[model samples]
Target: MKVDRGLLEKINFDKGNGLVPVVVQDVETRDVLMVAYANREAVEKTVETGYAHYFSRSRNELWMKGKTSGYIQKVKKILIDCDEDTLLYLVEQTGVACHTGNWSCFYRTLAEGDGNEIL
Candidate 1:
């Protein structure tokens, strides 16, 4: 879907910190890959290019994922929550979603039979 300016504005970008949370998921498998942040420019860039881009709060600049690490995420679809403060990205991922090299940022799972520690 082509996001018009008015629609984009309705997404309620968090300009207070100049960033918005972007949740990336694997569209086909429904596995969540990673979570990142995006500024207006990064959001626009992602829409314009069909790839994921993020605004680095640490670096204070725009950065494209997989540019240096080769873990690029290809955009499949984008959805906004009803409140429009957060975004969900259905994507095709190429490599580990976590910088720690985990398949997903959320690596730990609830142990099926054991309640002591998460898997």
Candidate 2:
């Protein structure tokens, strides 16, 4: 769907950090791919181009997922949370979602006894 600037503007971007958390999900597999943050411009670009774009807090800049690794995420649908402060990005992932080369960023799990372990 086209990115509607009007809809974007209606979101509560006024929250702390002025960014909304976006949950990326695999459309076909129903698996969560990753979680990232997106600023207004990032959201706009994602909707505008049908690609996943995020704000890199570390670099303080906008970045497209897989931009360097060529692991682009094709957006299928975007859903807003009830509070309008978060987003869900249903996408068709092309390659690894984690920089570690895993299919998803949530490849690790934390158990009560075991420390962080591979999932």
Candidate with top lDDT is 2
TM-score against truth, every candidate: 0.85, 0.87
TM-score of 1: 0.85
Off by over 4 Å in 1: 110-119
For candidate 2, lDDT tens digit of each residue in 2-95?
A: 6656667777774668888999999999899899999999998898899999999899999999889999999999988888888999999998
Number of clashes recorded per candidate = 0, 0
lDDT of 1 by residue, 61-103 (tens): 9998889999998897889888888999998998888999998
lDDT (Cα, 0-100) at 21 in candidate 2: 91
Q: Give candidate 1's error at residue 47 in angstroms.
A: 0.4
Q: State the displacement of the C-alpha of residue 56, model 1, in Å, after optimal TM-score superposition.
A: 1.1
